[model samples]
Target: MVDNIFKTAMRWALIFAAACLLLWVIMPEWKSVCAGLLLGVFASFLNALMLRRRVEIVGQAAGGNRRMGMGLGSRIAMVLLVAMVAYKNPETFNLPATLAASMVMPFFTLVSAFLHHKRH
Candidate 1:
């Protein structure tokens, strides 16, 4: 299930990234928005990868799972750093669009999972 979700999220991310690039080419004025969207997509991809790795580690552990907090904390810090940079540079980064794009991963994951289960 996790594998399916990861693949789905990645597919959507690539689609959106291509769309952003096209949009950037078509309208130079909205370059910031496109860049922000791409950044968000990248961040979301990293987040998904980290989550998958954490799950695998947990599954492999025999005793109580440790290091989960460190993993989560680092992810949070990385996201916050990206967000802060975007927020600080409104001229280059469209905060609202970035945030909207960041939400795409989980949305696609859930949608794909639901559809997969329905088909099964």
Candidate 2:
């Protein structure tokens, strides 16, 4: 479990770095990297929070535990994972395009996941 989490985190960090580098040939300036990373981490946190809330609601409907127990390890792992994925494909096809693509992709993923879950 621990190894899986660490691996996932590193993988995401690499992806994040790559994406940042790709966007601006010089690699993300320190400040940009800092800001971008913060955004990524915070996004991960928000995703987790939303997920936790969702789980809590699900449990409640099912008449179970009210507390959603998302582990710290998982949260940290997600942060790292997002960072790595960005680093991996830092190359932006186009500034505006990349921005739009990035924004939509995750939402698409979420919708797909939800649909898949519902089907399951």
lDDT of 2 by residue, 1-120 (tens): 323433344455456646655655554445344445445634543554555566557768687555545555665566555656556655522223323333332443455456555666
Q: How do the residues 63-118 of candidate 1 rate in per-residue lDDT, one tens digit apiece?
A: 77554456788667767776887899989888887777766777878888888788
The C-alpha local distance difference test score for the whole of candidate 1 amounts to 0.80
Candidate 1 C-alpha error for residue 52, in Å: 0.7
TM-score per prediction, in order, is 0.86, 0.32
lDDT per model vs. reference: 0.80, 0.49
Lowest summed lDDT across 10 adjacent residues in model 2 is found at 92-101
Best by lDDT: 1
Per-candidate Cα RMSD to the true structure, in Å, reads 1.9, 10.4
Our tally of clashes for model 2 stands at 27
